[model samples]
Target chain A: MTENEINHIFQTWLKQHKALLFKIVRSYAFNEEDRDDLFQEIAIQVWRSVTSFKQQSAVTTWLYRVALNTAIKWTTKERKHQDRHESIDVSQHIIESHQPPDDRLAWLYEEIAQLNEVDRSLTLLLLDGFSYKEMSKILGISESNVGVKINRIKKHLTTKSEKS
Target chain B: MEFKEMKKIWDTQNDEALYVINEDALHRRIKAKKMGTKRKTSFSEVILIVSNLCAGGVVIISHLLKNSGNVAALSMGAMMMIVGAYILFMRSQRIKRDQQTDVSILGDLENAIENINYRIKLSQSMIWFCLIVIAFTMYTVLNSDKSLLNIILISGFFIIGFFMSRWEHKRFNLGKKKQLLDLKEKLINEFEM
Candidate 1:
């Protein structure tokens, strides 16, 4: 496909599923700058990979896989040189406040950020309404494993929220 | 709450906070792919120059020492072998680092570090091997006289390169270890909070 055609498809995907990309980036980035960097990196990667995008899976599934993978890598890389920046406090970005979190949905996101990397990806895919088969394809896991993990994540989130 | 109720809440959650990409800017960036092209071109140029210098130097030294018989040939062969090995090792390391950067998953960090450590060891060994080769070359050039001055120079360079590489490897390992520790701490704090 031509670059223009790829750009058109990407624009449509971005408009429809931008929130998913944003949330994944936010969860993985240490700060706003890191989020923006990851956003650009993911966009570049998606653009590069779009030519090979077969319609075997939904666009949302492909996008989530790319975005999550990008964020995870970004976090891992950043963690190495993070000590150099003594002034940039990570705690500032942690969502902890008493403003009711703008509703339980915001609180849900705050909690999602607390999950481990694999669990966070699984939970985010579940929230995005991916079927077990789709989750399996995106995560390279078995459908049965997806079902088991999702059930465990649900219980874990409940206990976590109740304690809070 | 049960899974069903949790799903219900998740279904009803607002997702307006998600930021979508600006397609126009992205298109512009795609159109301006010159930077990547330039980087590749410059990288290839450097590799070409270094390879030429290494090969040319080996050829000239081999020819000059031609009258010295098999020992000179062996020294020349060993030098070329060292250079070829260094080039191959560096190329492999570059490819590995690129691949590591392309994929982003937490589980890959350890593998990346292991690759880095392997590269460091290869580099250290390369330095020592080159030093030994240089010492042999000097001894051959001096007709096995083993000049003290040449030995000092060869040993000095070897010691310096050895210590420098050793320091670099230590620093890299320390940095990687600290990063893993920080990641562990972050995960704990996030879950605990």
Candidate 2:
């Protein structure tokens, strides 16, 4: 594909689906610096994936797969290089003042931060209203496994929220 | 705070711009990242191939200039070139494997594990490469001067190089491999599959 085509496709998808990227980054990365780093990594992966996207699935599904895969790998790599610091020049500011974040959303993210990496991805998919079949396809796990894990995640979140 | 209510809250952010991405900055970064990744992917491979080829070339040229058919120098130079070619081939194969875009997270994880395993194997191969260099150098040195001190110095130099590579293997490759394995285990156990 031409440079212009790739750039156009990437920009269009990114503009349309920035929320999915943001939520995945927030769930995977706790600190602001790490979040930015993870965000950039996911964006880079998504950009690379534009050329390979053959319209096999919806753009959102393809994007979720790319973002989650990048985030999961980044999380693993980050653990090894925890002390290493990176300086990203991009200004991706979280505008909490413009649209005030719900306290429950904040609590939800905190709870998500507590889950294991795979479960964290599953939780995001579950919250985003993906069906067991969709989640299984995205995660490459069995549909039965998705059902079992989603049940546990729901119960855990519900019980935790009741206490909180 | 129930699951349904939580979903309601989560869905609220769908329309709202919770994060403001700098379009210009992001575009520039993306453009730069594209170029950087292309360069970064081949950097190590290029370095290894060039260094080995150059060293081999130098040895062959020096022997030619002296008008001497030194079998050891020629053989060692040929060996180095072969090793360089092997590295070029192996690294390119690995780069291709890593670039495969598997849409599933499980496939990505398996690819990641394979990538790290390849790295660990590459580092081990470097040790074997060092041994070849050391053996060739020792043979040439003994042929020229059967001196214990000279032998010790040459062996010491390669020994230090060997240890440095081993240190790097333990410090980076092993740590990354362990983390990837742990991640894979966590995912497998989570899925109960």
Candidate 3:
């Protein structure tokens, strides 16, 4: 495919699924600047990878694979240098009285922030409505393992939310 | 709340996640990225290049000027410098494992882990190669005449280099293996299969 054709296809994907890309980036990047950096990186990667896209699967799945793969490295590589696997715990985010956002989304983001690096990516996939099979496809795990981890992540989020 | 319910709430999440990016700007950046995607020359690599050029120049000049007993030793120094530059150039062109994004996450994850482990291994080997050469070069350049002191100093440098490489591997590479194993355990334990 020509570069212009690739650009058009990518532009459409971005227009429709930019939020998906954003959530993936936000999961890994600490701040706005980092988010922008990762976003550009993912964009460049997707643009590069688009022509090779066989479209055998959903574009969403392929896009998730690229974005998550990129973000995982971006987040883990720095932590790997420090020999730490646990990602930054954003559980302590307090909503100011005046700027009350959606409590569920805030809690959701906080809990995701607290998860281990692998689980953070997996749970985001789960939340985005990917099935066990699709998660397994994207994550390279078995269907059964996806079910197990999804339950574990859900139970943890629920138990914490209930207690508070 | 259950995940589905939370997901519903997540779907309603204001377009706070949205960031406007222009097509033309993205195209330009992609063009720029594609143009500049060569594996960057590392800081150590720059040092290697500069040292090689300067050292090679000095020794070759000394050999030509016919400094007493410097002829053979400086010629050897010049040759080693050429080899050093070649090593650094090859080091910069080291192959990176391609992340197979279109496959299973388990396979991709394993590939990622293997890539990290292999890169660490490459650096360790490179150090050993560079150490021997650097020691050889220093020995030849400093001592034009064969002497007991020359062998002893070179041996000392080799030993020091060996220990340093081991220490560095323990500090950096081992953690990557542990992280990989941890992920492995997390997967196996989660499924109990």
Candidate 4:
């Protein structure tokens, strides 16, 4: 109820859920520097918005809402100035860094990178074991829509994997 | 493996190995008011709107004082400010619309895809505005001085500018629109709808 209580609670949530920030950021940003920047941006947003949080939704759901909004807004701006990224294959970066050892995870990331911004967010939430109802609440969509979309998305990806 | 299985895998890959989330560092960054990432779109938009307003203010003030009859400057300034305001409004509205989805992934996809369309619209309108400004300015110049050579040269320049804008649309914005469309379709297909 008190401001300090809300602040303390939010800080704890943020600290414990640092990985939430990372998962959301990686879906939006292209490189290490961009990821760091997005993470900072999301953190600032959380800091500002957490006090106003009504506690109507789960803290993680609310956090995802804020993070996704920031990422979507940031991506729209970045898209205008970024060079043709396809021109530069990511294999070089893959070589240059400690890579994702799991090929399935790696493939998942690649597929996610190709997705539209919102789909990417939904997929991230889905992969994090969010229920359809929870995703619906955060995304402002219906439960059945989430279920149908998730089913379709899974079928789509699996079909792609099979064809390849 | 199933997608659920993949998610299970994703949940397991913790960030402890590399860059840990430094709460102290985040607090410092938040306190410093450096919330933005490296890109400066908001900053630049503010700069753009301010500059346009100043330019418009100067032109309108000068015209009122009758320093010169260059009404083109007033129109250009006014038009640019309108465009800037429209862009700023759209962006703010998108950000402020609360949640795009809470019940469905389809809602999220639709909102996201719609945002891309909005962007394409922004770029298209900007191009048209520039062309209209150029056309109006040239007409004003022609009306002020009616000479054959001037007409010929001005028409030539206008034609060149017209073509140049078309080229720009093809070279830049059209390609972007196509990409967005493809992505939208991909999302649609992802849901098998």
Candidate 5:
């Protein structure tokens, strides 16, 4: 594909699905600096994956796969060298919305932060109403495994909410 | 709240974007990042390849210039060239393998492990190769009609190099090995569930 075509497609994806990428970034990275770094990494991955997208799967699913893969790797790599390297300057490139925060959404993100990397991803997919089949495809796991994990994640979140 | 209620909360943000992107800056950043990544890789890998080849050439030329007919120096030069060629080959294969990895989480994890393992093995090979080169270089230096002070300084340089390489391996390669093992465990455990 031509550079112009790729850039245009990337711009379209950003306009339509920036929130989805933000959700993954927030779930994986807690600090503002880390979030910025992860957001850039995921965006870059999404841009790279555009040429490979064959329309065989939904665009959202493909974006999820790219974002999640990049976020997971970024999480691992970040832990190894936290605060050691300079961060990407994302302050001007991307900024959070000024909308008021919802307590429940904050609570949900906190709970997600408590889970393992895989569980965190599963939580996002489950909450967003993705099918087990879609989650399995993005995660490269069996459908049954996705089902089992979703069940456990639901139970964990429910049990935590009851305690609160 | 039940799962349904929680899903409702999550869905509320589906239409409300959380972050705003500066389209022009993002475009510029992506372009610069792409170029920077290419330049970084070329600078590191290409420099290593060229320097190794150049070091080998210099060694061979110096020996020929002095008419020393030093077989040890000649063999060391050849070994350096071989190591450089090996690195060139391995780097190409690594790039090819990297391009083939999909965006799936499992695939990324597997690729990470493979890349780390390759690095660990390469570091091991490099350490051994350095040792051999140091030994042969020392032998050549000693047998040459050099002053006592010169021999000691050259030997001292190699010894310091030996320690530095070991230190680097311990500092970096061991951490990478641990990361590889942890990733392997994560992959296996995720699948076992």
Candidate 6:
């Protein structure tokens, strides 16, 4: 496809699923600067990779995969630096933001934040109503594993909620 | 809470309030890619100037040695080669240094600031090395007499460069520490509120 045509297609797709980018960024970023940086970086990566975008899968699936990978890599690097600088407690940040008082949402974010990076991505995708197949594609995990993991996460959440 | 319960909250939450995509801003950023390219080109120009000066000095010394059989010319040529090699090595290292990635959201600002510090060091080192070479050439031009003056000046530059680099390194570390503390405080306050 021509460059202009490709750009148009990307722009259209970006308009539709741009919120997904924000969701991922918000889940991972610490502040406004980080959010803006991640958003720009994701946009650049998406634009760069648009040429290689095959039509075998949906555009949203591709976007989630790219966005999650970028966010995870970003967070891992930041965490290393934070560990060195000041022994700032990440749990404080996790707990303090948007408490939701009696709502289950805060608990959900806390649990998801506590999960390993890969599992966190999977859980977020599942929570967003992605099918097991779509989750597998975004996560590079098998569909069966996605199903197994979601069930396990569901059970874990239930147990945690009971304790609380 | 069960995944279903959490998902319900996630679904009902005001996503519109949380996420905003300014396409025009994004488009402007993409268009500004050329500015980054321009900065890189300017950096390359500095490298080119140093390399060309070193190369030119070598050619001149080589020609003088061939015609006059002067030991001084040969020594100058050798010195030029050393400077050329040093410049090339530094340029390659600077390029490698620029290629690092900071993917994390919280630490991205710190990493970027550090990268800028690294670039400043590279540039300062390049300038100092070039000045040292020029000082040596001046010493040679004066028939190698009063070599102590050249040595003192070179040492002074080296000392200054060392102190500058140390200061930059300390400042970078402090900035990183401050950023982490700020983020921690913000997060804490956010939780409290």
Which candidate has the highest TM-score of all? Answer: 2
Candidate maximizing DockQ? 5
TM-score of 3: 0.60
Displacement of residue A74 (Cα, Å) in model 2 is 1.9
lDDT of 6 by residue, B1-193 (tens): 5556677887754344444565444444333432344355446546645765676576566667667555554565666666566657765665564455333221233234344555555555555665655555555546645577776786677568657755754564345555546544643353231
lDDT by residue (A99-143, candidate 3, tens digit) is 236777777788888887678978898888889899898877888
User: After best superposition, candidate 1 residue A49: deviation in angstroms?
Assistant: 1.9
Query: Tens-digit lDDT track for model 5 on A17-40?
Result: 988888898899887656766776
Clashes of 5: 0
Chain A TM-score, each candidate: 0.81, 0.89, 0.83, 0.78, 0.92, 0.75
Q: What is the DockQ of each candidate?
A: 0.13, 0.26, 0.19, 0.13, 0.29, 0.14
Give the local distance difference test score of model 3: 0.64
C-alpha lDDT of residue A102 in model 5: 96
The predicted structure with the larger DockQ, 5 or 6, is: 5
Greater-DockQ candidate between 2 and 6:
2
Q: Can you write out model 6's per-residue Cα lDDT over A22-138, one digit (the tens) per residue?
A: 667667764755665567667666765677888888787888888887776666553423222223222222211232354466567677778766667877787788899898777
| 10 residues in a row with least lDDT, candidate 4 chain B | B31-40
Candidate 3: tens digits of C-alpha lDDT, residues B60-173:
777677756665556556765775677566654543434223233222333343444445655576576666566656666466565778767877776787778677667766
Q: For residue B5, give model 4's deviation from the true position in Å.
A: 2.3
Q: Please identify model 4 stretches exceeding 4 Å from their true place.
A: A1-3, A79-100, B14-19, B23-193
Summarize candidate 1's per-residue lDDT along B1-193 as a digit string, tens digits: 5556656666543354433344444333322232333344335435534653576477556666765464664656656655666566666665665465522221132233344455455545655654565566555546755678977786677668667756765675456566656665654454342
Query: lDDT at A60 for candidate 3?
Result: 90
Looking at model 5 chain B, which ten-residue stretch has the lowest summed lDDT?
B103-112
Note the Cα lDDT for every prediction shown: 0.60, 0.75, 0.64, 0.63, 0.76, 0.60
Query: For candidate 2, lDDT tens digit of each residue in B1-193?
Result: 6799999988887873655775555444434433343444466568778988899988888888987687997889888888889989988787777677353332343354455456567678877887888788777888874579878887888889889878877886677567667766767776765
